[model samples]
Target: MHLLRIALASLANRRFTALLTVFAIALSVCLLLAVERVRHEARASFASTISGTDLIVGARAGSLNLLLYSVFRIGNATNNIRWTSYEQLAAHRQVKWAIPISLGDSHRGYRVLGTSQGYFEHYRYARSQPLRLREGRPFAADPFEVVLGAEVAEALHYRLGDDLVLAHGVASISLLKHDDKPFRVVGVLARTGTPVDRTLHISLAGMQALHVDWQGGMPARGAARVSAEQARAMDLQPEQITAVLLGLHSKIATFSLQREINEYRGEPLLAILPGVALQELWSLMGTAEQALFVVSLFVVLTGLIGMLTAILTSLNERRREMAILRSVGARPWHIAGLLVLEALALALAGALLGLALLYLGIAAAQGPVQAHYGLYLALTVPTLYEWTLLGAILAAALLMGGVPAWRAYRQSLADGLSIRL
Candidate 1:
């Protein structure tokens, strides 16, 4: 305890340098921890993007491709499943519910999804949490009514009763605009921190009506053009859809259903367990995640090196102090112990300050991050892994301090009672 007091007093005498060292370490520590937290949260968010659905069925394609287009709204599907097949599968006894997904439309830059009221009823994310509306109700009988996702509504500044036109294609800058089939926003879903938030939802009938008058991928001219009312009056049953999300009646039936769907003779189809596909997707990204973590580790090492440099540089100026202590009967090990204590003190202070900064940053950026990126950075206590990382940092600091401690020990023994420069 006496040695700790002396070491702290000595650091107080050089408060400016010590503070700078601590601040440097604090910034590095904060950065490392922040990256780790984001990585963990991103993985969790990615895995929870679509949950409670036992299987995702799509027209024959790679599992990753199907997962991307179906859940992520990424690339276009190679082929669309026939609506007849969807009806047959949905009516299967093993299937509890099925939500069909129709893509290839966009509102501004956001993807427009054509689904039934079943999507709003059964689609879930983040631990089976059901979709909730922030305002208004889900689209009812009106084929022209639409429901806006949280991000779509917030980013485009749309509200209930607002009318918007969707383009025929999924391009960000689409040439073929479905101007005649204007849809009214009847509902806005709450922010879900998933791809769902970045999508615009509409009924399957609405999707068919948009392109009902278009032939050969081009809109009809003059009398051939169908107005919204005319299209609504006609049958709007969808012929094909991009994918289907299925919930099984029992968890044990997931594999059986998947096998059956894969072997279906009605049409070529692929069914993948959502959990398996998610794990596969995450593994593909593991390399980049590890690379990021390694980079942050090097940053932390750089900060520790800076601390080592500061301590070693101060050694010459403090030689006289060490000699005085030796003259006053201080043992060489005592001097070494003091230097180690100083390093530990700096590390502890830095770790604490870094934790404080992390929480403050999370609190400040939580809203904007979620608003723009759909990544909710929860302000919660550090997990066990984080605590372990901090502990490792302290241990590394202690190990690094040994270098200066050994130098101080040798110098104090040799320069006993003598002032060196």
Candidate 2:
């Protein structure tokens, strides 16, 4: 108890340097924890983005490529699967339900997804969390009605019944606009913190309506243009679709169904288990993840070095103080213990402060992060791994404490009592 008081009093005397050391450690700890938390949450979010689906079937292409374009909206599909194939797969006896996704157009900057009501009923995220409407309802049977994702509605400031035109391509700036066939916002979906948050959903017929006047990806010059009213009467069946997400009747039949689809004689196709493809995608990202972790670890090491430097520097000024303690019957080992305690104290303070900063940061930036990056950061308690990290840091701090403690222990009373004698 007495030694603790002495340590506290000594730190209070050099509070400026002590506080600075604490602040540095705190910031570093914050960065480390932030990296870890964000990494874990990102993986969780990505993995859960399209769960409950047994397979994602697309035109024969690399599994990673198909997953990227269909799920993450990260790239363009090499080729779209035929609408006939999607129909066949959806009608398969072993299939529980299938959702068709036809991607090509864009509303402002958000991807326009052409899907059926089955998407609302079957598509899920974050482990069976179904899509729900925050305002209005899902797009009705009308071909011109559209549903906006939470981000799309908030960003474009669209309300129910507001009409908006979509661009033909995914580019931010495109000359081809579907102005002749504007879609009215019928619904706004609640935020899912997935790619769905940035999407604009429309019926497959609505998608076909936009391109009805076009041939070979352009408006036919001499061809008659169909108005919205006329498009309602025209055939709106899509000839091709980007991908299909399927649920299976039995988990045991997943591999057999996948093989059957891949071996289909009509057209070359690939049926991939979502979890397996997701793992492949994550494997490709492993290098980047490791890079982030290494950078954060280095940052923490720098902070610990700074604390060590501050303690060692203070030791030189405290030699006389140590000699006085020795004269007062304090053993050299006691002086060492005091130094160790101070280091541990700084580490402990920094760790607690870092946790405060982490949660505060998460709370403050949660909305913006989700809005811009589609990353939903939840403020939660530290995990066991996180606790382990804190423990490792404290252990490192103790080891670092030994350095200055040893210096103080080895110093003779003469070094403190005699100055330049």
Candidate 3:
């Protein structure tokens, strides 16, 4: 207990220097933990995007873009596939089911995904987890019912049986609307913290019905608006759609099915494996990710370097104190133990403080970050990598602490209680 008290008193003597060391380490821990969290979540979210789905088919363009737009709702489609192409692909023997997605619309800031009932049943995300409606139920065959994503419902404060007018384009003001036919909100999905949380889902028939009277993307330019009763009589056949999400008959047939899909000649279309396409996207951003990781490593190095500087600079002033301790029947090893204990305390305190900050950051940014980027930050216990990271930090602290201990040991041997200032 006496020796422990000695360690505390020594550290308290240089409170400013000790605090600086702890602050530097805390910042380094923050950087290191952030890098670890992002890397782990990126891979996890990417892989879990389309677990049960096997293939994504769309008009000829970059497969990566098609995957991003159709699965992530990230960008607008470059081109639309003919409706005939969707029917032809859906007829394949290897395909268990297929869901057509029509884009080019939004409600407020949320993307509008016009799909079929199959989408609600077959669509999966976050580890083969099927979509579960949180409130009310899925949209009906009725042309005016809408099923909103979790985020859309919570953000817009809509409940079942509410009314929503689809925007003409992806903007709030697109000079177009199905003003004559507003959709009734029938469902609200549970938050999955994925892109699905931001999408407003509606039946493809509803989308086609909404724009039946408009010709060539304009509102018929002052033509008579058709009533909802008249729209039911008209053919709501969609000529084109943005993409098709697919399910395979069997997991083993995925590669073979992908090969067949790419060679499909019904129209100029491309088939992509969502997982593979995600890797392509990540590879594009890999350089930036690598740079971030390198920067974090340097931050950790900076912290260790600061500890070394603080100790070496304080060694001269501490030399007399070391000699007094040696005269009081203290062994060189005892002085060394004191340095080690101080280093351990500083490292642990900084780590705890930094971890607390990380938790707070995650909580504060959880909603906005997920809404904008579709990336969820979890604040659970540290993973194995983080434990290893902490170990490395503690190891560095010990190494720097040894410098002061070694200096004091040699000084005490030569100047035993002699004040040779």
Winner by TM-score:
1
Ranking by lDDT: 1, 2, 3
Candidates 1 and 3 compared by lDDT, better number = 1
Model 2, residue 182: displacement in angstroms?
1.6
- Best-to-worst order by TM-score is 1, 2, 3
Worst 10 residues of 3 by lDDT: 411-420
lDDT of 2 by residue, 1-421 (tens): 8888999899999999999999999999999999998898788777887889999999998999898889877778888888888889989999999999999999777899999999999998876778889999888778999999888889888999899999999998889998888899989998888888889999999998888888889886644887889999989999999999999999999999999999999899999998888877888899999999999999999999999999998877788789999999999899999999999999999999999999999999999887565578888889999999999999999999999999999987777564442
Against the hidden reference, what TM-scores do the models get?
Answer: 0.94, 0.91, 0.83
Q: List the residue pairs that clash in candidate 2.
A: none
- Clashing residue pairs, candidate 3? none
Give the Cα RMSD of candidate 2.
Answer: 2.4
Write candidate 1's Cα lDDT for 1-421 as tens digits: 9999999999999999999999999999999999998898789878988989999999998999999999999999999999999999999999999999999999888999999999998998877889999999999888999999898998899989999999988888998999888999999998888889899999999999998888989999999999998988999999999999999899999888899999999999999988889999999999999999999999999989999999999998898898888888889999999999999999999999999999999999999876556577889999999999999999999999999999998873565455556
Q: Which segments of candidate 1 are over 4 A away from where they belong? A: 363-381, 412-421
Clash tally, candidates in order: 0, 0, 0
Candidate 2 is scored at a TM of 0.91
Lowest lDDT 10-residue stretch of candidate 2: 412-421
lDDT of 2 at 32: 100
Off by over 4 Å in 2: 360-381, 416-421
Name the lDDT of candidate 2: 0.90
Best by lDDT: 1
